[model samples]
Structure formats: structure tokens, C-alpha cells
Target: MKGTQSLERALDILFALGDDGETQTIAEIAQRISIPESSVYRLIQTLERNGLVERKGQGQIGLGLRILELAKSLNSQFRNRLKSSAAPLMEQLSEETKETVVLFVRTGTNVICVKSVAGQHLVRFVVEDGKTFPIQNGASGKAILAFETSKIINQVIHTIETDLVDDFLEELQVIREKGFSETSSEVDPGIIGIAAPIFDQANHVIASVTVAGPGDRIKDEKLSAIVPHVIKTAKRISSSLSFSTTLS
Candidate 1:
């Protein structure tokens, strides 16, 4: 019983630290968890020794390199699963649209391309795998942002220009309602792209599937033809991922 209590207390402290992604002093952690400062200090010492927590400047503590190591391993495995499941569908979308197809997942405030299938045409816009861009622009970003929680949405908006925040939020709403997002020159000049969100078993937006091409070849008619295919491809990836999650 005593061991269990200590474990719970340690978890409480960890949870508190995760809330705002900020360093916290021992006193602050103890107060937040309603524990004695001395006990908190002992618990922190054990955590520090195990590489779960580390001291920041000015007597503050933050998550340690061990946590990042674990996160990296988990993220790599999860991204591999996502890429494998998304590849066939993305390839089909690329062939059908004759444009670049990319799979993007959010990391912090940025969206990264985990997989990209190049377009067939010589004039196609090329997006390489592992490319990262801010979530404040592009159809791929908007597709994922539209389904994010309100807190995350507001947090991302706070990083944008004050004058553009409202417009960006409104655009998210429109994207949510429309089931997908499309843009021209939003991230790259002379490029057009369309994207739809992929969801997990719990219905959280885990990623986005995007189709992009050179603007000259992707005029209104081309854009209209490809949007449904993008939406469909995203749906297939989401469905497959959700089903796989349930099996796991």
C-alpha cells in the first residue's frame, strides 16, 4: 500500500509537469499535488536518478533526456506503422491525380511529411519525405488543425500574427465543415494542394493525406476533380488505422 501511494504521487507530479510543458520547482509541484515539500523532494530525487526528470536552472525541474529517448522510439514505431498502412492508398491517389501525395503528422506546432509519393508528370511539384512546415499554413496543416482540440487550436493561434488569428480560426471552421481543405501558394509558390484529415480509433486527427501539384496544371477543373479523391484516400487511411488500433 505504501509503495502504491508513492507511485501515485510520482505520477501526479509528472502529470502536473506535462500540463503546460514548463519547468516547475519542488515547492510548486508539492503545492499542486497537495503533498509535503520534503516528500516531494525525495520523490523528485528518485525520479532524477532514474533519468525521468532533470533540474533546470533556478531550482526548477523538467522532463529529462530519457523521456525524449522513449518518445523518439515510440514515435518512430508509430510513424512506421502509419507509413506502411498509408502507402498503397497514397500511391493510388498519386496515380489517379497525377500529383504528389504526402502523409503528414503533427509534431508540436509543426506538420511533418512522413511519406510522399511523387507525381507522374514532369512538371509536378515534389515534396520529399521528412519535410516539416508550420501548422499555420497549407492545406495539409489546415486539414489536421481543423480536427484538433480547441485548446490546441487556441495555443497554435496564439503563435500567429494577432491580425491573422481570427481569419485563421475561421478558416479552420470552414475546413472542418467542408471535410477537406485546398490552397494555392499557401506554403510553396506556384503550387496547389488539397488535403483531408485521418483519424484514429478514438476519432482524434492523427494525420493528413495531401495531394499537390504545379499551379499551372492544377486549375479549377483539375482541383475539382482531385478533391474527392484526396478525401477518399484520407478516409481509407483513417479507416485502416482505426481498425488496426482496435485489433492491437
Candidate 2:
């Protein structure tokens, strides 16, 4: 924890939201942390100012963009924990599927790749560690977005094209119901992507683990076989993430 009572309370607010597993109001946050509502309000304002948290609709609060920047120096420990949990599973998945593997975290209305494992095949799709794209673009993004709160879903909806809203939302619903997502030629040409969502202990969708490769090799039948491995690896990483004490 940080020094000073006020700073400590502010950090607890972020932790409380994560533990609760969803957005909450000022009162809910105060009760969860056992602090007065007024004190929580003030601390929340300060945190909001620093880009550490965000206010969802109807006064609910959530982890902000800065909090999701796992690869940055801002929160290296948790990033280390995330990578520690995902790296091996991702590596195993790439070896099993013979395709590129990627881990993605949401940043506001976009999704960023925090880590990647290249495939064994000569013509496989390649992913860069720092790659970023709109939240609506691919299976990697959609897998994470589909599990987010409605306010977040709507927030993203407002950023993309009007015509795309219907189809995108529809696709997200399918992803939510199915617990994964798939896309072809979305991020890159002739590439197919299949992704599964990863959750923290509180059951929040923290990120997504994706398997991607060329269309010719991954065509329908092979894609079906690879899906299960992607999902299983995602679950394994999520289970490892539960060992982390806090988002910090």
C-alpha cells in the first residue's frame, strides 16, 4: 500500500471495485471499504482526476484506462503477474495449435496486445507485443468486450460507425453466450482468429487469450479442433490469475 491515509483509501477504492467484480456506486464503494460515503466520494474524485478510475453511467465506477495499461511501468507488478500467468499457457497453446497466440487487455474503447507468442508454422499469422486496435475489430477485442458491463459496451458503441452498431452488438451477445469469439480477415487479410475470455478471481473479464493463423491451414475443420485448446488455456491462465492478491 502507499503512504498516507488518503492515498491508501484511494487505492482501496480501486481494489474494492475489482473484488466486487463489477461497477458500483459511491455508497457501495464506501460500504465495501468501510469508509464514510463522503470520504469515499472525495477519494474517488481524486482518483478520477489521475486516470486511475472511471465513472460509468448511473454513478457506477470502474477501473479506468490507465489501470488497464498492463504493459506500462505504471503497474508493472500486476503486469508481471499477468504475464507470469499467461506466458506459459500462451506458449503451450501456440505449440499445440501451431498458430500465433496473443493476450489482449482493454484500454478505454480500444484493446491492446500485452504479450504474444509466435507460431511454429512458416506461414502463420504474426502478432507484435504492442499491437493495438479498435475494440470492435477482431476476436481478441470482441472476446474481452463481450464480457464488459453495459455502460462500457455502450461507450464503445458510440465510438464506432453507426451502421456497425447493430452487427457488432449482436456479435458481442453471441460471444457472451458462447464464452468466446471468432473472426476471419478482421485484423489482417487471410487470417482467422479464435479467442476466449480470461477472468480474474472476482469473475470480471480481465483479458482475452487468442489463437490466430492463416485461413488455409486453419480452415473450418482445423479451427474446430483448435477452439477447445484456446478455451482450456484461457481458463488455466485465469485460474493462475486468481493467485494474485490484488489488481495492484
Return the top candidate by lDDT.
Answer: 1
User: At residue 206, what lDDT does model 1 achieve?
Assistant: 93
Please write out the lDDT profile of model 2 over residues 1-248, one tens digit for every residue.
23598878887898898765589999988988898999998888888898888999999898888776742665567567888889989999999988999999888788988999999987878878778999888999999999999888988888878998898888898888888899999989999999999998999998999999888899878999999998999999998888655543
Q: List lDDT for all candidates, in order.
A: 0.91, 0.88
For all predicted structures, in order, the TM-scores are 0.87, 0.73
RMSD of 2: 6.7
Error of 2 at 47 (Å): 10
For model 2, the stretches where C-alpha displacement exceeds 4 angstroms are: 1-74, 244-248
Per-residue lDDT tens digits of candidate 1, residues 12-90? 9888887878999999999999999999999989889999899998999998888789889999988999998999999
State the lDDT at 233 in candidate 2: 93
TM-score of 1: 0.87
lDDT of 1 at 144: 97
